[model samples]
Target: MGEWDLRRLRVLRAVDECGTVTGAAERLRLSPSAVSQQVSALARQLGAPMLEPYGRRVRLTPAARLVLRHAELVFGQLERAEAELAGYLHGEAGEVRVGAFATAIAGLLVPAIARLRESAPRLAVRVVEAEAAGAYGLLAAGEVDLALSLAVQPGGGDPRFVQSVLLSDPLDVALPPGHPLAGAPGLRLADLAAEPWIYGAAGPWREITLAACADAGFVPERAHTAADWTAILAMVGAGLGVALVPRLASARRGGGAVVRALPADLPTRRVVAAVRTGTQGTPPLRRVLDALAEVAATVQPD
Candidate 1:
């Protein structure tokens, strides 16, 4: 229709890939209003609404879906062009996509990304936030070039993929500030048995936390479940219930919560990089792992 319409298509593509206008705004670093306006502009250009309602989510109209496919092709071409340019300037080209857990984002990935930006300036990276199992699934599905995941202690391990230990951290119990245990020097496993617990979302996490409690001599009574580390910590801060969290998650939380070691007798969770056994072995992938190594080195205890 017009030049503005073309820009709108890019907005549409961003929204579709990001899953929400809010998500698109974050990626583009644009205001939510800007994102919404672009999508609406595209509808005007098409002379009809291209996004229809489907329950609470928006469903792409047929025309919009067709446009989306073309957007993907355009994106692929853009990637190739960038790669070609990089290859012309250097010996390698391409981008790496990575996924990691919330705790790792704070404890590990931020510094890694910063180092990668400074040292491997030529490499392009896309970071996705997800849990351990999801990170592995992304690795298997080729949705990510690298996955930073947690190795649940003593569980057999993933047979189909390759793993390299990135680092390990102990898990601890978080109690709300001013709680009776907040002022205690240390707490034992049995001490936590009767406390209402905050279990990490149902997955290997549930098993790991439960197993730690079991090692302490009693199974913790579950009071709630949450996937979001912030929410879990916030709840703990509020004194809704106590939670067992990795040390990293406990770092940023200050809402009257006290963290205590879960005894020296238990196993710690090891975070690692899982790369699918075989892939292109691209430069972008290697750069990411190298950056991660740099990040790990800084945090490892001497």
Candidate 2:
């Protein structure tokens, strides 16, 4: 054991990786002689030869390799520490960008942000409206710190992200004001099997709707296809077709459409928040996630 200086250890690692003093100097933005001197001092401190010549390049001695291995671990831990410190400093006074679908933006994201403004005034929340898949992409690409999506299993089990289920948003049936099922307290999805259907864009929602309908022994006649819940509801209100709507998305009924809950086991999508694995430790991100959960809890699932 000896007094190990990180600076010297870095110099040794650089020289080992670069294969020459000049190469190490260039990488470290130092003169070649300076790099040599640092390595020399490190050799003296550790009481062991740290480098060996191999042709025109340099190689790490057995002892130097051991030291460098440990040095890498130390450097990594230090980097993580710095990141945590930065997170703490910025948690209450920094900006966090979020990606979410339109309905989440309306029913959960916006309200969560408003709550953040009141509680953490210095923390600014930026939002981008995107669907679940797109939002998850943004999160993976580092374009956003957090994403609100219906895809609870984001990253498909990729270890790079942490997914938290914020809530289970249930799917409801949208009916026109004078429709036969408009006033029903609880309706079986099978009962509407014969009705014209306005389905969402082809994706998870459509899959759930189709699966539920299939379980009910019928296939909905796709009369309209719209991505936006409001648009879907409008189509329903015009008596064009009935559609399945997520409760969070239908916070405000449009086009004179009435929302009716389906049977308990029908269909529901999990509202999940996906973040870079280590970002959940950031104070600001944690605050925003908490606020989202709080707001989501207040939503009365139809």
Candidate 3:
């Protein structure tokens, strides 16, 4: 048989639905002769009779019934494809991969994903836990659609990525419960100058801790080194030393420690979302970015 035209298949299905050439033509707003001509053309193309005389009207032949059954499935699939395409065009569907640090995975990305479940249920999000430094590499390599990272120096960020600030997460001091300044009010980073500090041995958190301390005029005496927030908090709780904890991680401060707010001049780390320079405007990427911002707005420092 020659190639089947979808328009002819549609006309055949309409005839089956309406039960007569006149009725199908009236339903389709075409004249009865045009309807008969299309059906006759389709029959010739398929080398089979599609209609037969049945009393004063017409009935489908066996071949026409089989064609209509398969045509129904084809039409259903076409509708589904169109719907999916519409969703992709509107930023409501498709997959988005994101690279974020551990704290961001918990504090921002997870919440943003939850919000997307309600707002864009068909949009799939895949997450990679990566630090600020590595996330940029992932973004550059196109391994991720978005990257949640700590803000780099002013005018020092990569030109290949577009960055947007998500939130400013304050850094608070986690002190052992028995420490002299455990619950101190009006606390300042300078007050902890002489205290032993527990911090990440490397990564952006280490840089943030060291930089904030330097701005306060004293280098913190390193008492322990740990990259995991839970481990650092555990060490602080065990009286191993105080640690600078970002508000983003404060919620996980397990036990035996007191998290205290610093003076109004409290130090903070800027959290940002990054995407490939020009691709930030992409549908799925933009939807994920907007969701992150919405979730970030609800994150308050305790």
**Number of the top lDDT candidate:** 3
Order of the predicted models by lDDT, top scorer first: 3, 2, 1
lDDT winner between candidates 1 and 3: 3
1-302, model 3: which lDDT tens digit per residue?
87778888888888888889989999889999999999999899888999999888788999999988998999999999999989988899999999999999999999999999999999999999987778888887889888888885331366787889999999888999889887667788898899999987777888899999999999999989898888988888898999888899876888678888876657999998888888878888889999999889899554
TM-score of each: 0.65, 0.66, 0.86
Against the correct fold, how does model 3 do in TM-score?
0.86
- Which regions of candidate 2 are displaced past 4 Å? 1-87, 152-156, 184-186, 264-266, 300-302
RMSD each, Å: 18.7, 12.5, 2.8
Top TM-score hit: 3
The models' CA-based lDDT, in order, is 0.74, 0.83, 0.87
Cand. 2 Cα-lDDT? 0.83
154: Cα error in model 1, Å: 11
Better of 2 and 3 by lDDT: 3
lDDT of 1 at 230: 76
Clash count of each predicted structure: 2, 0, 0
